[model samples]
Target chain A: AQRVTQPEKLLSVFKGAPVELKCNYSYSGSPELFWYVQYSRQRLQLLLRHISRESIKGFTADLNKGETSFHLKKPFAQEEDSAMYYCALSFTYGSQGNLIFGKGTKLSVKP
Target chain B: DAMVIQNPRYQVTQFGKPVTLSCSQTLNHNVMYWYQQKSSQAPKLLFHYYDKDFNNEADTPDNFQSRRPNTSFCFLDIRSPGLGDAAMYLCATSSHRESYEQYFGPGTRLTVT
Candidate 1:
């Protein structure tokens, strides 16, 4: 079965500290991965995709095929960064398929 | 800014009552999707419409149904909502030409009494 796993339910960090949100996947075929975020009082939006390989809002995620991981990282955290993050695995390798989402991790940045 | 919109951000309905959630998108994307998210759980795909073609998830309950009247709007109808049916219903849209990024609405929080 194809699935996405977010090992941590919550990750708390102080301002200016580095943070990492781990995401792992189990899939028999090539996988298209994504990181989505929901900020307080805001809609859930796409944070980044493995295909893009670009950073957004000081955050970056690298897809490691061997380890089956697409961990999101930020060198320095800010209070405004607190939000719920979900890692998703797409059914199709082409990026258009049912998105299988992980339970999600809540990141809290303390000032 | 053109975006996906969900009506009645918060809805309260009685048990076994029929309720409908509305979603509209101004982006004119080729695909629109509905997801059900229970408390502290990941959002699950309920169904989707890709340019009038409807696709339902294998495990989605029959009590739930959806309709896309046109390119810009979609509706999720719960025929007989039970207590367990309460959840945050999210609406999202994506363009076929655009790389897999989805634009989401604020979502509707449905409460069953």
Candidate 2:
């Protein structure tokens, strides 16, 4: 069974505070991990991917194969950063077109 | 420019009534997908079309069906929507196969009355 898990349904942080959204996965084989964000009244879009190892909009996600975790992190949070973030895992095979997404975490950055 | 477009941003349908949601893409992608997302829940894959070949999820109910008449358009038909069928139907497109990056459309919120 392949599944993605985001432990926190909501995370609130003060402006300029550090923010971390945890995500974990369970899969027998190697998987591709992704983080997607959706703003209010906006469509969901890709924020970053584990393979790229790059930061997007001051956000970065590290993939730990040993722990099966791909947690998204940002050193300083901003009010505009508040949105619904989803962690997804892609199966390397067997209907590769589909991505298994977690329930998602809603982040709120207050001033 | 919107790569994907879903019409009728909000839809209301009576219980046991059939409803159709339409989606069109301008990216000329070969693969299109339909997902059902409820409030505070993850989006569940209903089905997808890869160049006219429809692939249905094992757990998808028969009430939910999809059609891709061409590469640019797709439709999701709910034969008889139930109360639980109310959700946000999302349409997504990818340029190629097995790609992690997907462009999503403004979802259609379906309300079952």
RMSD of each: 0.9, 1.5
TM-score of 1: 0.98
Q: Give the per-residue lDDT digits (tens) of candidate 1, residues A66-96.
A: 9999999999999999999999999776645
Model 1 RMSD in angstroms: 0.9
Candidate 2 lDDT over residue span B51-74, tens digit each:
888999999999999988899999
For model 2 chain A, where is the 10-residue window of minimal lDDT? A90-99
Whole-model Cα lDDT of every candidate shown, in order: 0.94, 0.92
Judged by whole-model lDDT over C-alpha atoms, candidate 2 comes out at 0.92
| Residue-level lDDT tens digits of model 1 in B1-113 | 99999998999999999999999999989899999999999999999988999999999999999999999999999999999999999999998688647899999999999
Q: Which runs of model 1 end up more than 4 angstroms from their true locations?
A: none
RMSD over all Cα atoms, model 2: 1.5
Q: Which residue ranges in model 2 land beyond 4 Å of their true spot?
A: A93-96, B97-100
- The CAPRI category of model 2 is medium
